[model samples]
Each structure stands twice: as C-alpha cells, then as structure tokens.
Target: MSQHQILNPADHAQLRIHTEAGAEFGDNVMASLAMPAEFREVQAHYPIVFRRDAETGKLAALALFGFEAGENLFLNGSTWEARYRPMAHAVQPFLIGRAAEEGAPPQVHVDMGHARVSATGEGMRVFDDTGTATPYLEAVANMLGDLDYSWHESDAFFTALETYELVEPFSLEVTLDNGSVQTLVGFQTIHEERLSALDGDALAALMAEGHLARIYMVLASLAQFGGLVARKNRRIALG
Candidate 1:
C-alpha cells in the first residue's frame, strides 16, 4: 500500500512531514540497520549486531532496540529515549531513487502513503510558498546523501569481516526481574578469538581500510545490552 513517487516541488508543495517519534509512524521496531560510519554514535545507545539476508546471504549490521519484534525499548510514548537514532529510522518516508537512464543522478522519492506524510499543514513543510525547498527538506536531503554513501561503505566493511573470518553467530538469554526469560537468536557478532589470532599484516589491512575501529565499536556496543534490559525491566515495572 505504499505510494512512492519522485518528489517535486510542484507536486508536493503543500506536503508536510510529521517529525514526532512514535510507533504510529512505524518506529516500533526491535532493530534498525546500522552502518560503519555511524557505529560510534550507535554503539553508545544500542547493541550492534549482524544479520544475514536469507535470499542473498549478504550480511548487514543492525542496532538492537529490544528483545522482541515490534518492541522498541527506546520508544516511550511519542518520544524515543535515545540520544541518537539510526539513519535507517531517521530517514523514514523518504528514500533515494534513480531514473531509468544510465548514469543518472539519484533523486529523492517520497512514500505518500507513509504515516509521516501529511497534507493537513500540521507538520514540517517540505516546500515554501515560492516553490523552493525548505530547511527541513534540505536537512533530509543531506541525511539521504549520507545514508546512500554509508550504505555502500557498509558492503565493503562486511566484505572485510568475511575475508578476515571475524564474524560468528551470537545468542543471548535475558531474565527479567519478574522471572520471565527472553532469548535472542539468529544474530551475529565479531569473533574476538579469531580477531586476536590474525597476523599483524591482516590487522594492518583492517586498520588501513578503517574497519578496525568500527569492529571495536561493535564489540563495545555489546555492553549496551545491559542498559537495554534495564529499560525493558523498567517498562515492565511501570505496567
């Protein structure tokens, strides 16, 4: 039911985007895609993990928000209780698109059916009365550009991880204060043992390509799981 179209000032002049954080805008998710460039910021708030595409067998990074599907521990009513949100979630309702012609520049595409897309003049405007892009739109465009570039960078980072054999399956079992247990499965994390086993040359290669810091960031992010669990327990206690 998504209505996607190339964004234009004339067609979407009156369009406004709801900027609030809430589940009604599809923010109730357990995880969001993470990129290497943003791993530092993401690691401070969420645990970074990897998931493989079943069809393509491609590995992609994810920032965990909760232990279960559609349950975002960061979401507290209309507010997201985090200092940063992943670009995958922040960009909502907007995406980069390409034209049919070869070598065409990327274009901004909007999902008209998205919950954030509104025409009631109740949200941030996409365009001004003079048919020019608004500040909000400009900021979104910059974010889209960063997301597009980081997406390709993530591919290289994953490829490097595979080459170094640094990835391994990970699982966790969390027991709440109320004695309920939740098990997280089907995610992957860096193999510290293998990573330590690598020779100096391999380590240099990773560092040269800027993947070493990100790898450590991912490792550091695992500690955030305790904070996530605390949030979950607090939510449970409140209810």
Candidate 2:
C-alpha cells in the first residue's frame, strides 16, 4: 500500500530524492500508461505492450522489462540498462494527489514509505533549509504536471484504438539455452493487420489525432522482444 501525503515544504523541508539509478527502487514491473505522449521515448528502449490492471481490469499500455513478474532484467547493479527510461517510471515516489481543498486542484504527493526518501545530504534535495523548493524539486513538479495532462491524451489515444478494434491478444514463446520453453500470456498488443487494412479516411483521422505514428511505434517496439529474451537468458545464465 502507498502512504501518499500532499507534498509541502513545511512538512518535508529535509526530504531528499534518490539520484542513483531507479533500479534500487524495488519496482520490477512498470506500467506504461503514457502512450502517444511517451510512446517514442519508451519505444526506443523497452518493448511496448499492453496489459490490464488487476484491480480495475482496465486495459493499459506497458513496457516489458522481465519475462516473469517481480523481475527487472534491466537492473544492472544500481543503474538500469536502457538509455531512455519511461517517464512513468523515471519520476518515482511522487504522484499526482487530490488537493486538500475540495475541487481546488490536484497537488503533488510523495510516498512516505518510499525507499528513496531520506534526510541525508546525498541525492537531490527536495527543499532548501529555508523551506523553499529547489530546482530539482521544481523539475519534479513540472514532470508531474506534464504527466497529468498527457495522461488525458493517452486515455483518448487508447479509446481510439478500442473504437477501431485494434486491440488484440499477443503471446510469445521463447526457448531458453537449456532447451526449456516458456510461454508468456495475459498481454495484448496493437493489431497491425487491422491497422494496415484501414481506409484512407480512417487513416487520415488517426493521423489528425496524432495516434497513427504512436500505433506504428507500438508495433515496431515488438521487435525489442528479442532483446528482452536475450536479457532474460543472460540472467538465467548468471544464476
């Protein structure tokens, strides 16, 4: 469970954010819900796929990092292997929170129990001694704000995919070095066949909505699965 508290310099003047790679943050499975907005950045390194939320059963986009649950193959010591980290995962321990005043506006909140929080001098400072936000803190605020806005756009993007019936189940079968076969399920991907068959008007509409490129990006990201499988194999070899 998360203990989210509305971030305030008064209550968190001494808070410090972790500056090292996010690999130590104990987040193996990262949800890639920032499609359309973050598709290009995420696609450059991670395999963009789709999954449904266990609690809400809501379909969402995701960037795969491991073959199994609770495993992050990109975790190379304290640093993640990817050149570009998903914005959804890059900003850790902070999230959009409901404002204390009713209907005022959403505010940024920090997880009190997050391992990244510390009172020490190392890492980025959340606030100055006089209880003012530092540059790093300001950047985090901007990121959170941007994410809040982009998430709405991403929602519409996914809705368009659903409307066009482009969502389809995807399965991957990989053979490990020891000749053991593994089947991955419970995931989905964009239907390229349907996309390729769309009429010019529909394709133009998708282009107008800025979703066509992202849909193609999602399709292209599947190629990274070969890398993911190799990574999983490397981990197994290490063991």
Candidate 3:
C-alpha cells in the first residue's frame, strides 16, 4: 500500500525525488491519461485514443504507448525517447488531494513508498534545509497545477463528444513483418461518420468550445501507431 502523507516542508525537508526515466520508475504502460489541452504535444509522439471508464463508462482520452498492456514504446535503455512526456506520466509519487472543507484549495500529497522517492538524499531534494521549496519541487507543483486544469478541460471535451455521439469503439488489426497478427480492441476513438453528421449548429458549438482541434489531433495521432508497432517488433527481434 502507498504511504501517502500531506507534503509539508517541515516533515519532508529531507525528501528527495528521483528523476530517472525507466521501467524501474514505473512508466510501463500501454497508455496514460491525456487531456485535450495536451493533444498538440501528445499527438507529436503518441497515438491519442479514448476508452470507456470501467466504472463511469464515460469516454476517457489516453496517449497510447503499445499494442498490448505493460509495454511502453518510448522506453529505450534508461531514457524515455520522446520529445514530450505526458504530464500524467511525468508527475509521479505526488498526487493532488481534495480539501477537507469545500472551496478550500487542493493539497499536495507524496507517497513515501514510491520508488521515485529516497530519504537518504540520493535524488533531487524537494526542499532545502531551510524548509523552502527547491527548483524540482517547484516544477512538480507547476506540473500538478497544469494537470488539474487539464483534467477539467479534457472532461468538458469528452462530454461534448458524448452529447454529439462523436465517440465510438475502435479496432485495429496489424500484421507484423514476421506474419504474426496483433489485434487491438476495447478502445474508442472519434467517430468520423458521426462527427461528419453534426449539424452546423453542433459544429459551431464544438468549435466554440475548442474541441474541434483536439478531436482532429486524436485522429491524426493514429499515424504514430506504425512507429509503436515497429518498436514492438524491435523488442521481439532483440529477445
């Protein structure tokens, strides 16, 4: 279990956070949550897709990594080979906590057991001896702020897609060079047919909400799948 505690400089003055990128850092995944605000960056490296939340059944956007689970294509050696790493993936060990009272600001909490953290000062210090935030901590705080804002913005975009019936299930079947087949399923993407069916008024609403561009980004990002499949092929070949 995660031993999460409120991040206070007094109690965590010695806290250090690891900045390494690798499987040891727990970035192994086929996908990570993506925000509409991040589509421009995410589309450049990863395929953006949507899936239904297992609990809420609402459409959720993600930056795809590989064709299967627990396989992140961007990982090479100990580095993440990408120009842009999603904020959802960049912010680790620290989580945003809701305020105990309504209207209060959210609090930052750190997972003491997270592999990225070290108490022996092996990594970047979160605070100096004077209990002041370090540059690393400041960056994390900024990232968290962006993540919080993106969550709301992305949620609104998904709601708009749902209202217009523009989200639908997607399937992929790829034949690798070795003749093996990789069939990907249970994912969702923007439905071009339904999206095209939108009336002028509905189209105007989506455009006004800034959802139009993000939707096209998701569609365009699918081109990166060829690279993802190639990465998988390399891994298999090396093994």
Instruction: Please identify which of the two predictions, 2 or 3, would achieve the higher lDDT against the true structure.
Output: 3
For model 2, how does the per-residue alpha-carbon lDDT over 1-239 read when each residue is reduced to its tens digit?
Answer: 67889899888887888867654565566344545688888888788888877898667888887777777788877877888777677777889887568788888899978777765666788889888889998998898888888877788788888889898988989898878887789899988899989999999999999989999999898888888888878888998
Backbone clashes per model, in order?
Answer: 0, 0, 0
List, residue by residue over 4-118, the lDDT tens digit for candidate 1: 9999997998999999998988899999999899999999999999998999999999999999999999999999999899998899899999999999999999999999887
Clashes of 2: 0
Stretches off by above 4 angstroms in model 3 are none
lDDT of each: 0.94, 0.81, 0.87
CA lDDT, candidate 1, residue 185: 97
Q: How far out, in Å, is residue 141 in model 2?
A: 0.9
- Candidate numbers sorted by TM-score from highest down: 1, 3, 2
